[model samples]
Target: MRSGIHPETRPVVFRDRAADTLFLIRSTAAASKTIVWEDGVTYPLIDVEISSAGHPFCTGTARVVDTAGRIERFQRRYGRPATHRG
Candidate 1:
């Protein structure tokens, strides 16, 4: 709560190129470019490569790897048999 000791937190826009999405949130992130939002107001625009919109985790596209299944799939595709040695 001290004055002049913390970076200013202001409204900024984050753009996800992968998802082609734009989010308006308050952040201390610095921006070298600006863009006019839908409200006809200009805000700092930060370009991001990934975000929830484009992330597999959020989009339910992530695969849960099963070791046994993975080995079988790999063997089938590559024709390298999986060896189990005890």
Candidate 2:
């Protein structure tokens, strides 16, 4: 690990737009915008589209992004039917 070569990492607030949530975390990301946190200290603001609060896997509402469709199509093109082994 290098000392001064790495970007400055500090406490930043990540706001999930979709979930309407805010959490403080240490990150290297920076922003000109700032907001006062619960501790009454200002921190850099980072707006995110999605986070664990709104992610499909975390929410258990997975979305099919046509990848499943592609797999189904490939299987239809080259798959064989199961035969009775008994």
Candidate 3:
């Protein structure tokens, strides 16, 4: 509860590139850019590479790699027995 000892907590916008999504929130982080949010007020803008909006799991488009199939193909090409286990 001390004064002048904590970083400034202010409204900020986090933008996700892949999903073209923007969110309004509060943070103590600093940014060099700013943007006007839906509330018609300007706030610091932080550009992020990924967020829940663009995440595969959140979007329900996650892919499961076929490791077993790849191992079988490799064995066939090398004439070796497949030793991979699920």
Q: Considering every candidate listed, which one attains the maximal lDDT?
A: 1
Candidate 3 structure quality by residue, lDDT tens digits, 1-86:
99999888888899999999999888998999999888899989999999999999999999999999999999888888668898
lDDT of 2 by residue, 1-86 (tens): 97889898899999999999999999999788899999999999999999999999999999758997898898899895678899
Give me candidate 3's TM-score against the actual structure: 0.78
State which candidate, 2 or 3, has the greater TM-score.
3
Name the candidate, 1 or 3, with the larger lDDT value.
Answer: 1
The segments of candidate 1 whose C-alpha lies over 4 angstroms from its true place after superposition are 71-86
TM-score for predicted model 2 compared with the true structure: 0.68
lDDT of 2 at 75: 84
Global CA lDDT computed for model 3:
0.92
lDDT of each: 0.96, 0.92, 0.92
Q: For candidate 1, what is the lDDT?
A: 0.96
- Candidate 1 lowest-lDDT run of ten: 74-83
- TM-scores, each model vs. reference: 0.78, 0.68, 0.78
